[model samples]
Target chain A: MLSSSKVKLIQSLNKKKYRQKYNLFVVEGIKNIKEFVFSNFLISNIYTTEPIPFMQEHQYQIISHEELKKISFLKTPHNALALVELPDTLPYSIQGIQIALDSIQDPGNLGTIIRLADWYGIEQIFCSETSVDVYNPKVVQATMGSLARVQVNYTDLKKLLTTSPIPVCTTDMDGENIYTSCLPQEAFLVMGNEGNGISEDIKSISNLKLTIPRFGKKQKTESLNVAISTGIILSEFFSQKEKI
Target chain B: MLSSSKVKLIQSLNKKKYRQKYNLFVVEGIKNIKEFVFSNFLISNIYTTEPIPFMQEHQYQIISHEELKKISFLKTPHNALALVELPDTLPYSIQGIQIALDSIQDPGNLGTIIRLADWYGIEQIFCSETSVDVYNPKVVQATMGSLARVQVNYTDLKKLLTTSPIPVCTTDMDGENIYTSCLPQEAFLVMGNEGNGISEDIKSISNLKLTIPRFGKKQKTESLNVAISTGIILSEFFSQKEKI
Candidate 1:
């Protein structure tokens, strides 16, 4: 049975504060819920309109479609919504081309970046405290199922860069061309905010600065989207790895 | 002054049929409007709350914030909005790397692709007739101002591929690794729909197939987002050109 208090609690999970307070995050859709079910994450509750074959062993409540609509963050509600316990943050020992996001405001951008990072075999991502919450529902939906595989850590970006053992690289306009540059295998590739690029302080501390050269004639395109830039840069880094 | 008739006309533009009937589309934000004003596109009217120094010679009307909210499509409306006449489609002579979008349904994906195309110096994009309208307000807003520089045309996808003189490359799972493949300087890189990917009919006619290899250990990520895939592939294609 769908209760008013349950619906209110589910709706409150949309905000970071509420999600943190409950120590749980919402994952919608049967496919996404299945991912969390199989991952290291723990599922607290599952609400669905129909019986899920894969989730038969888990405790779940069958609710009407109308009830699903009340708690769904999407414009079109998926068949299922699962409240999963937030996984405890594990200490990250970076061993590869880790991504560092500085003040990434858009949830969609952060989500897409995570999905791409998974495709490129990137295991970890470090985000500035100012970046959008990884548990944001819009972000969770956009990541598809990749979020379950990738590890995202939130920390102080400046301190992380300064204390790093390997080289720290930042994407810059006047930096060495990425196509010809000798990219390090082990490094922190820091991506900046959507509007401002990288912060001046972060840029000053970075050991290497690389750029994706533009081929457009008019030179009018202001910049590439942060997520798109991440994908392109990562593709290049991995492609170079294959050559060696 | 904002009239009821003007408000109705602007709101009607949100629909594809209405936009085609009027042969006009909406461009919001002072920066975006400026791009169209300087481009070959004709500006029908401009509505703003503040004086636009660049648009002083152009016909414009000052409207209050409440009135602007009624005419604007954005949740948070920018200072200016302009109606631009849709440019007549130009005959595209396949020259460099042209993009063919097969049944692309998402406006944001199309918009981001268009923006990236502009940055990569891809002058023309051909879309399947079933694809989402390029003039969609959501698409226009997402493109930033790249819509002014990049030309998007809609036509029969299968027919275009069959008639094309150069190689028609399609991104597929079983195709050649894009990192190692010999990419052509002049070819049509066809990106598929958001969900189903390139239609069967369109895929059958393609001369070549390309795939972005996944590095993730789990291989659980079903597929990269179509837009992100496009960016990665395009980056590789362009990077290869610099090597030659």
Candidate 2:
């Protein structure tokens, strides 16, 4: 059984302000809750339809389907939902290849990129202030347990790029072809907003402007989606590894 | 001003059952509305805050901001929202290089692929029946007006690949390295589901299995996002054209 106050607390997490005050975010669905149970994150609360062994480390409540449904954002409630404590603010660490986002607002894109970063073993991900809330439940779901492994921090993209010791590279249509561009092994790769591309301020800070050259045709497309572009660019880095 | 009945009608469009039964789908934003206006699609109704001269040829209705707000599904109501008559069911005439998706449920992926197809001039996209509804407002929004150019259809992916006249190639980790593989000028490239990759049932029909060779350390990423893989594979086709 969920207390009225507890239900209100869970609902309040949907807002950024509440999330800030509590330093907690909700992770919905069976797949996501299970992943969080094993990760290092502090499980503040667990609402489950059935017993889950991983939650043995943390206190949990066996809630009925109706009670679980009350707290679920999903129209069809999954078997479980969890409220996880956010990790400590990570310091800006520029080591190997890092991915940066400039005002990417979609939760799915942010989450998928986090997963991609985890997959490629990227050093870190830097997000501009306007990027989607990384702790958004949808993004956490999309990350597929990757949120535990990758370090994503929100920062001032333009300021960071200017002071960063490493070269900052960004993809642009008019830029040199990425296929032939001599990219450094350790660099900061910046992706821009879905509609606006990279901000003008950050664009000026980039050391190199590269492009994933499209095929010869009448391209009605104005630009590639930033996330998709990131994938291709990251693959280029990964493909090089396959050769050796 | 939106009448009570009209407001209710517009809100109903958010559901797939309504869209399918009425053979109508919503297209919002000034840019998208303008694009679809020029296309062959018939505009049934239009509600806008700003004036649209192109819409003179089609049947339209001017509504106040409050009325537009009542009907709009977007988080921030756009300048305009339109209801367009769904295009006539297009028969698949697979001729040149075509793209097929197996169980791709993300609207953004579907939209990005649609836009990419439009850029490369690949006219048709074949999706599994289980894929997200193409007319989902999110899908339409993500396409960025590419819906005007690309024709998308849902069908049995496995059956189509088996009988497709052109070669069917799907991306896989164990498959041949795509960078050096001899790719055909015209073939059907099948992309798999988001998490599961390609389904085995469809794999049975894959004639030429190709892989986008990963670079970096082998243990880094488990696999690439299907949409990112789509961009890379499509870029290669275009890359050859650039050489020409």
Candidate 3:
């Protein structure tokens, strides 16, 4: 049985302010919640209609389907929803091939990018303060389960790029062709906003500018989606690293 | 003034049955409508609140914002919406590095794939009949303007693969590493469904199977999103072609 106050608190997790205020976020679906259970993130509460086999060892509250629907963010609510405590913000470090996002507004794009980073073994992502919150319900859902592994930090991107020890690469329309260019094995790959490319402050500081050359005859495809571009660029970077 | 019957008719276009019955689809926003206007598709009607500079020569019905909202599919209605007649289906031909989708149910994924194909100069896409309709409003919106350039066809994927004169390639988990493999200059690349990848029938018929190797240590990410995988594979194919 869910108390009205408890339901209110869970539903409020949908907003950034509430998430920050409570230091908690929502993770729905048994599979998604399973990832967080083994992760560093602590589970604050688990509201479930059925017993999750893997989660039998953990404490969980049995609730009705109707009760589960009340707090679930998805249109078709999953069987279970868990309240997860937000992980502590780890200090950003420049390691081998990192991703920096500049004002990526779309939650789906950010989530997809995080999943891509996880797939490519890029551990950390540095997002501009203006980028979408990593903990957004939509972003979390889009990540599938990669949110458990990928460490995403929101900070001043310009400052981070300026003080970087390695080369800073930005994807551009007229830059040297990505295929032909000599890509650095270790650098900060900065992806810009959906509507605009990289910010001027961030772009001017980046010495390496690479472009995924357009092959279409019309040359009318404005640009690839930010998430797609990230996948393509990351694949290229990893492929080049493997060869060396 | 938009008629009540006309509004109902426009709203019905949201469903596949209605779209098929009328042989028409709705395209919203001035930029998107402009693309269809210049394409092979014919325009049946244009409902707009503001005068469009490029559409000056074409006929359009002026309507108030309230009227536009009533007829618009989007939450925030675009300045205009146009009803574009479905183009005649051309016979599917095996072209250089073409894309084939097997039961891609998500409209956004289909649309993004179409746009990615346009970016890589792959002109045609053959989708399994079970795949989402290309004329779906969500798909049309996601394709940006690329829908105007790329041709998408719905057909029996198994039959198409079986009859293909060119090499048939499919993305699979246990396949040759894409980075190391000598990719063909011209092949039919088949992308599978979001959940269940390449159907057994399609998989058995494909002679060449390629995989984007996973680099994450945990290797927990089950698979990349179908659309993101398409972008990476397309980018790799083009890169190899350029080198050759």
Inter-residue clash pairs, candidate 1: none
Best by lDDT: 1
| Per-residue lDDT of model 2, residues A1-244, tens digit only | 7899999998888888899899999888766676666656788888888877765734777899989888887778788888899889766668677888999998878887887787667746999999888887778777767787676888888888888888898877798876665557767889988888898888888898888775525454557677778877776654444434
Q: What are the runs in model 2 whose C-alpha is more than 4 Å off?
A: A55-59, A90-93, A214-222, A240-244, B1-24, B55-59, B69-75, B89-96, B136-138, B172-185, B194-199, B211-225, B236-244
Sort by DockQ, top down from the best: 1, 3, 2
**TM (chain A) per model:** 0.98, 0.93, 0.97
Candidate 3 clash pair list? none
Model-by-model lDDT, in order?
0.91, 0.79, 0.90
lDDT of 3 at A162: 93
As a TM-score, model 2 comes out at: 0.84
Listed in order, the DockQ scores are 0.81, 0.33, 0.80
What TM-score does candidate 3 get on C-alpha atoms?
Answer: 0.98
DockQ of structure 1: 0.81
Q: Residue by residue across B1-244, what tens digits does model 1's lDDT show?
A: 7889989999999999999999999999999998898889999999998999975645788889999999999999999899999899887798778899999999999999999999898888999999999999999988989999999989998988899988999988999998888889878999999889999988898888999999998867869989899999999988888777
The predicted structure with the larger DockQ, 2 or 3, is 3
lDDT of 2: 0.79
Worst 10 residues of 2 chain B by lDDT: B213-222
lDDT of 2 by residue, B1-244 (tens): 6789878877888888989888889999988887787778888888888778765633666778887878888989998998988788787687778999999998888888888787667877999999988898889987888888788888988888898999999887889877677678778999988888889988888888998654334243446667777987877655544444
